[model samples]
Target: MKKSTLLIAALMTFGTVKADEGMWTLYNLPQAVYRQMQSEGFLLPYRDLYESKDAIKNAVVNFSGYCSGVVVSPDGLVFTNHHCGFEAIRSHSTVEHDYMLNGFFAKTLADELPNKDMFVSFMREQKDVTPQLESLGYSRCGKDQQAAMVDSLQRALTDSVRQIDPTLHVDIDPFYEGNRHYATVYQDFTDLRLVFTVPKSMGKFGGETDNWMWPRQTCDFSVFRIYADPKTNGPAAYSKDNVPYHPQHWARPSLEGYQVGSFAMTMGYPGSTSRYISSYGIVERRDAENTPRAQVRGVKQEVMRRYMRASEAVRIKYDSKFAQSANYWKNSIGMNKCIDSIGIIQQKRDYEARLRQWQDSTGFLKGQLSFPLLEKLYARRQERVRTMMYWRETFRRTNEFSTRAMQLATGMEVKGPKKNAAKKYHSFADNSNEWDAALDREVLSVLLKNYREHVDARYLPKFYTTIDTRFEGDYTRFVDYLYTRSLLMKKGAKLYYNTKAYKADPGVRFGQDVMDVFYDLNEGMGAINDSIETQERYLCAAKLRMEADLPHYSDANFTMRLSYGQVKEFELGGKPSGYYTTPESIVEKMNRAAHITDYEAEPIMKELLSARDFGRYTDKTTGQMHLCFLTNNDITGGNSGSPMFNGKGELIGLAFDGNWDSLSSDINFDARLARCIGVDIRFVLFMMDKWGHAHRLLREMGL
Candidate 1:
């Protein structure tokens, strides 16, 4: 009779459990989930998966804090997505020796290229800390205060650990939408070096055109090795004396390929997901966040594409930047489309109605978790949020001059000896070679004009007044004037830091004006944002209580998680989409490269792929070299380089992407449509042996 009663009745009549769903934490995987995994063909014992020192979890590493990777050899050889190592590749590339264009392979350990600020972290352990935090009044603290408390706790834990081992690090992150908390211990190895990579033509094969799409042929892999202190065999900084790290455990690379319905699993750090978000939050993400991001980045990327095509130097400098921007730009577009097509907002609303009914019937968190309040708050902030997204995409790191000026402007605010020290360290020459002045000037003018036209007049930076008054409302003229007068535009310029002169400089003034707008927007939305966060947390708590009978996994926060599924395929356009792609697909795409440049590859690629004598890399069943495959494993952004393993825990491939039709998986996981895209391990080995002739490294892996 009552809504809550109806909710219960519906649950009984139609079960809500879905298979092949969840980014499950390994330390405390639910017994029920494990049973389901067993049904799906998981072969290892529970302890073998997580508890033992030789567990596969020990081999997974947080790749430079952005992606996932795995140790695959006794020599600490690591494998990750080509795009994961993109910046390192770009940093080493030059016109004469372009590693990105021609690829790189270290013939000897001494030839391995060292990267600055590159480190891989091995997660040692994770445990719940909610009870401890709750005892210290963490549950009673307001949303604004919890962050500081967590930070203090984390620092104390980290400092205590460093006393014993300086290489160890600690992170305390909230889970289940802050209803639970866990502390993770990690050991970091800082000295990482590039070992092998395929050229961009092969590594980034199919490029943006095939990214997030099915039937992918991209190899999408790169190799690196970790170095440790020779004496202690512990983490160390780069030194000639450092030796190759002999890890306690590593994944065995399997040439034995997978078949449709074969057991598949992925273990790695997934960046973030909003599966617990309310319907109002979905609306906000769609209209306020994804919409503006897609629109602004599309305009910016076109400008970058034009310049990059015109010059090889510009292309090399901006390749990494362009790829980063383009990856998410298309993601936003696909996410929005999937959100609408899947009717995710409507589904969430229906679930929220049931949750509200349950709360009302039980009088549990009835007043605290108010859906109406969430709707009102989101409605009030939608315009400001959209404007903020536009502002961030338009100016934030899009223009080199503006980014440097902002740094100098912030540096000017410090007082005392620190102020002078900051001035001494400040130099425009830092990374000055990464950007072209002509490209930057053009980008500045285009984004400035676009920002003014799209956002409200009140949101415009103060420099717009200078343009109107002095340059007769011409963005190009104003940008040219600033470039001509500002020392910040000079490649090797030094800052004098005189208050009057610094304030009067057009570059600093522009940066300060932009920052002023940013500060104002943030300040105005501070209370509103906090209110929204509080509501969302309570909503999550209420949902957990209502669905207490169901097994739940926490939302991903760039921590290690394992997702299990099968090598499976889905239907597209009323036809079955195959689970794997072959070299034939690669050749077909290349043949059409004249119309679709994304398919263009090195001339050698065609010959190598077309070869009939493919040796052991060829699949025995299909008698073809598989380029990529599909699995139903749950994954997200930071799972880019995650290892996809067969039932025996042998590495079969590296997870690189998700199908475009399931782009809304971040907010809503659709078991029917969602699938993970992985580059086959054999494809990686084929490239290493056939293309690069990397026999020494292959022998090290015992292949």
Candidate 2:
């Protein structure tokens, strides 16, 4: 695409889209970005329940559940919605003490100190009494103008929160486009310890592999206790002597399950999503971009994950990559399943049918499109399918390798052009905290070789194919340069001594002449080549798409927006599947689907099944099993750990996933099909009492 065209596309996908539901405007968010975040549950808390403005001011939390917590006792016993403690729980677990897989319970306050890095954050107060916001004027401004007005409103609100509570952290979020912005305040508290967590078999249960899936059986819950100083009544570290926090409001943990249709609200921070997009945008992403890209990446991730699991060598070498890749792979699997789900297709059909009728009645989009023309465009693209995929995959893979190399090179150059760049090699020592110079040298060598081998040659189009850089004058010259360069030898080695040090070293004096000769030329050539390639490819794709009658839309960029819906189950695969599946479903699946682990070995599930008085959990509204509860709450990626609460302010469930039918819920909400799923609080309580055996935690809450 041309630079201008690419800029326009980015603006449309990232900067401009919004979610609109009939007369109810969700927010200006692109649909693709909206669905991605929505599926992840990032839109749950339209407004969170913070005690005061001081809390929001000191909160440094962003992206991954920074510091949101609950006050469980009159002494400020902070309670963070579980999941904020997942990693910490896992970290403290082992074969003997599998806090994650087997779960943990601190019988008393002293016992809770074992789980490290568990924390709770509190924002004490908030104040937003601004006359500027109260005053309204004619709304004739453009979207940007309106956005500016909202920004001003939010800043004022944040200022008020900070002024009222200087010690707390504050952030102002925009909601409903420019309609409203609230100053969210948080009290930052870090000293938290594990109070209890059900066994991993129950807590994580199905694990990431089954996360966000239905007919799903995972408890996905945990608990942490907060401690504070007796004298100050302020934040304190988790010392064995520290007293339990005295909180104002404590959530009554109940064994009461929610009904099928319950009135519940989610209180937490939601990330961001974009539900505002054109149909033209949707077709492009679903049909052209994400599906194919995800497929390729999915295969690679799966293969790497499998190898990592089986081979200790591969596991050690790629543990970091493995950790990073797991979520993406799991997400791809879920997204693919969701995209292919019957509900999503049906929803799309229903939307098209509605739009078709509207188009017929209103000339808003008549004759502007022709089905045959669109088909022709598809046919043209089909001819070059292989090339497109190859280029995309090559770019994706090489981009990763190239970024690492650039950072490494930059660091080396900054350290000075040493004989063999020894200073640069030491930086790796710092990064790994491994002072073994030998290992650092070996690893750096391996990394360079790996980058050269894995990174596609096409990525270096300027240097490899074109005779622009002397480093790539020919294959022989390339080989010789590698051998002679400091990258391949030791500081005292003869090969290193002869080679010119890295040019434009910025600090080093060694290779000034050599570096000066090639620095600008090399850098300028690379920039020009990349720019040309990007422009050419975009223009070519655009021309073809115009012929094909299809317009391409970029992938979903994370953005904040609202997605509206209600909680309800839909008929699929010939069964009335509720929006959530319980531990019961999990046990059944473990009996049927677990590849190797025995069903009986998972004590948490066993305990759940064996509970004598499983307790008559009731939502009072639907009166269903309530293994999982559904809500009309709008959510997306960032809302995962949010607490789903009843109107009377009881913890109901943890917002987890959306129904498959709601995959397109971002573009257009279909209340008939879309539903947000959560792990019922009843189940959480059951696990806590029966499996986690955290009675002390229960007693502390007066449950």
Candidate 3:
């Protein structure tokens, strides 16, 4: 067959263009893709999307480091997911003023709570840096060497940029499996304040039961304001003198709700996707990574759940921790199920086979990409990777004491001044306010036992010997002894600059033992990992050459991307799932809250939602308030707070989640099943007006 015919055959086998797929970067988006987007219903001009000074992309901000958000008012009032702001909410909550439970609304600027170390970043520009790297022989170097070069270059560029403007941040990221690179410059504002939030019962209404499921009504959004230097409206640290930032552009909120086929677009920083990974890599991820994560987190969460249910204090302390753990635990379980149900691994294998045939026929990268070598490398590293995941899940931050103790132990190895060491020790030691002793002790004991049962005897930490021999294999007894004898567990403990005393502490010894095992496991995998990385890069390059005609988008790397689709629905259990949900669904769920704890809500929530008048928030066509809607926009983790815009570039909603059927989308874009779930913008306004009485914020958004 001819090369074009062979490519077509490969495309047919891979099903590359199914539905509205791709998380495309706006800077270098193909004209073909742009035309397709316009055909689908995108009405914004190409220049207005990114190139113009008042572009829509200017309004989008990276929420802290893990999520996305959009500026909605000229005063820099931003909208993001409630769960994305979870840590900030948890930090400000005290027994006297539990913001997590009662909710918080700033009636004025002074009332907005300032958060420490919280910031939002705006991407100023992104330009291709591939030519510069290529001039330095980046393409000819090994993966490890290229990484080092990139690091050096990035630091140099950042330093130069800072010399010109101290507040700008720079990130040089590799794209297309390291075949290309882009430097993104950002201006980070460090004085973000909490503007508004709903109570836990409303913000997290559906909880885990409806976490990744469809037909949902979770109002998963929160509000904040970014403060800037009053002199120049540039980035600034938190201070009373700082004022709300005046952005060049802000998304206009629209009360006009969308229909089943209304155009939808989401622009945000998606965290990760491995769409170009090999079949062997997929198998390893499924068995080694996801399996251990799901299994171990399940055990840990159960312990936390029991303690949390018994004490409100414990619940407040562990709420954020549990949410983070449970979010990914459920995701891993769902991803594994989808991998099997959709035959993702076999599908990858089929695609690989076709690619190899095309390469052999055309002599395009025929000898460079070796599937057998990739397979062998993965096989060699699988067991060690599995053991490492188990080790990580068992010890890494499973409890507060061990985590702090490990930091202290690691600090002991630094050849620094005694004063510097003392400062580091005290910093690690002053975490008493973060965790409860009883709850952490219980968690450590359970995970200790769990770790030993799963890992090999040789892989056990040296502390396991202390437990096995001295404490007679009683994990609880051993844990109790460490807690009692270690000064690290004491609230007012001090180091006193005594290295001998620190080394002799039981908690420090336990920490050292854990680190030793981790170091050993990591060292053993270094060469195997190098080989696998090389093979994967070759595989990616080969695929690019074989299908050069296709509009290939790179895997997500927490960079800003735009995904366009429509407000569409999908089949669930062989039935047509509706495109949107209404307040009635939320009321129905609250009615069943007695049996299903996830559905529980505050009494006031029911009263407000049950009210007859939704005012202007009501959808004219349906004559009811729409809660959440579904779209087919490709998204992943960091897109949590992404703004969903209608064809006219008006903010319609904030994307918070993906449906359960699309859990495998990270590896395989099952366009038919993948759906982005977003909370309606009107619902956000309704809650603000009715529950929070936040008319100031509503008026600021021009609602």
Candidate 4:
């Protein structure tokens, strides 16, 4: 057989259900994959996973476009990860309530709290619309031309679709580098209400230290319900008269839990991945992109830790911010470690070598220069990429509060559209006030000095030089000068302030100067990226041509996808990595005060674990309560809260985190090491029944 044929077979089988590594889509489950599912113990009808009227498809939802959830009962009771709904939980909490500490369990429907601006969207339908998008035949067009064409066509299509139903949101997403397209019509339901949640001590056990790590014991699940307008049975803003929605399908939670070798399928939205990215892209990401991000976040997190430890109020205010930074900070560190350890760059090089060999033999491949152009473009833009990374890490990430100031100043600076401009400025300021000036100033001080020292002078925004000449490189004093009198820092000051007030302010002027430089630098970056994207699309077009018979699944883009795998064990360093974590294993690590940010194994919970209290929901074979389990389901960030179903399509677990070893999955999947960590559904039932004593909620689930 030819080497290309062998490569095609390997590609199909490598990151798949057989190897527990493919993030397969719901649009079409391949024939080979379907046969593999049946062989592995899947008992449901093949079409059930994708058919519009099926239980599975109707039950699952896209949670506010950020995470996934499943309806557990006909009354619209939804279940998702605690972190996915963390913002709502935090909003409802205060020093008086402290729901984050003790948790909430609505004993009755009346007790359920309505949340503002929270929503869940269900997929109405998805269809291939490639021909419609490609009819223009502008594959070779420049960025401007492509954008104009796409925008015009999209507007026309969306307008026509909206005429049928004004509420439906129909998005046409491109796949295979614009070679294919799919349109998914969505039904968005607002007026979601909080039903129940475990305490932070339990839901977020082990804290950031245990995030993305296995051998886990975190029951990261939250419950909510969708409320629909009584008359229309459609989404509406929160109202007292609203009634609970009864969805078409809901998942049946099983106490007949899974074990090692049990077939599992994960269905949810997964965020972005760059599996088809070039080796040049890989090198740039590993060294230039991720390196600075990790270092900068590490520093910022240290500053946040100090403030959080000093005051509980501060901790509550910055909890989400810290978690967002820490997530990728650790991932970047892990990616750096594993990319070298696992030789990912070398793997890409080897793959490229084969591509080159194949190209040499084919006239069409030999004639195209896009493949090598990708490498040269990335290399040439390395310095600009480095500076932008630093700017993003320092100014954009750490000094986010400063952006609010900038936004307010810019909004005030607008000359025309007086009434709307006033409303816009006020709204932006109102929303952007979710930051602590004290903490932001500290971050700004530390980051500015770090930024000046680390970033190259030539690539840096011109504001740095101004700060140097004016403040003599004392970044702290410069920050003090900016924050002390700047209207942006003056809380409760109405947005009606004069534009000249903003123009005269030092901080506002500084922000404007920085933005001006940023815009100039970005123009340069925009050109490079435009070229890269064009070349990348061409390369994608070429590869599909080259590997004509190969099976291809589009990269994840926070859209609904289905990944099939199994409950299996792994090993690291000659030690067996077990499938399920028992209660006894978690109790031994109980230390209330060892780590300030870490969750303590409380006495009540520690006792339960140590006593081995196997409730009715316990695994029958082991007679031990399973806290969490592991599966290789090719999931990413947005998969948090996705239902992990048994082969019988019964809810077995709630997918939450991916294993640390699989951090490189976005660019290159690791079949042997990649694993998805899930909270066992049995344990969730046990906790909901015994710990939370929310039997009323259980009864609604038909328990």
**Top candidate, metric lDDT:** 1
Which has the higher TM-score value, candidate number 1 or candidate number 4?
1
The sequence of per-residue lDDT tens digits that candidate 2 reaches over residues 39-114 is 4334433223332322211221222243233444444444443455665765565445546545677676667744
- Residues 192-247 of candidate 1: C-alpha lDDT, one tens digit per residue: 99999999999999888988999899999999999999999999999999999999
- Measured against the true structure, the TM-scores of the candidates, in listed sequence, are 0.96, 0.60, 0.95, 0.93
Instruction: Assess each prediction's global lDDT (C-alpha) against the native.
Output: 0.90, 0.46, 0.89, 0.79
Q: How far is candidate 4 from the true structure (C-alpha RMSD, Å)?
A: 2.9
If both were scored by lDDT, which would come out higher, candidate 1 or candidate 4?
A: 1
- Estimate candidate 4's alpha-carbon lDDT, on a 0 to 1 scale: 0.79
- The C-alpha local distance difference test score for the whole of candidate 2 amounts to 0.46
For residues 577-660, could you state the per-residue lDDT of candidate 4 as single tens digits?
888998876775565336444658557777666764576777887888899999878888899999999988989989999888
In model 4, the clashing pairs are: none
User: Model 3, 1-703: lDDT tens per residue?
Assistant: 8987975665554333643788988888777677677777888888888889888999999999999999999899999999998889989998889989999999999999899988899988888999989999987887778889889888888898899888876899988877789998888999999999998888887888999999999999999999999999998889999999999899998998988989999999999999999999999989999999999999999999999899888888889999999999999999999999999999999999998888789887667678998999899888888999998888888898778677766764233356674543444436666788888998999999998888888888888888989999999999999999987777667654456777788887888888888888888678888778777878898888876867789999999999988999999999999999988889999999999999988999999999897989999888999999999999999999999999989999999999899898999998789999999999999999999999999889887
Model 4 misplaced regions, further than 4 Å: 1-19, 159-164, 409-433, 462-466, 494-499, 592-597
User: Which pairs of residues collide in model 3?
Assistant: none
Question: After superposition, which runs of candidate 1 have C-alpha atoms over 4 Å from their true positions?
Answer: 1-17, 412-416, 419-426
Scored by lDDT, model 3 comes in at: 0.89
Model 1 steric clash pairs: none
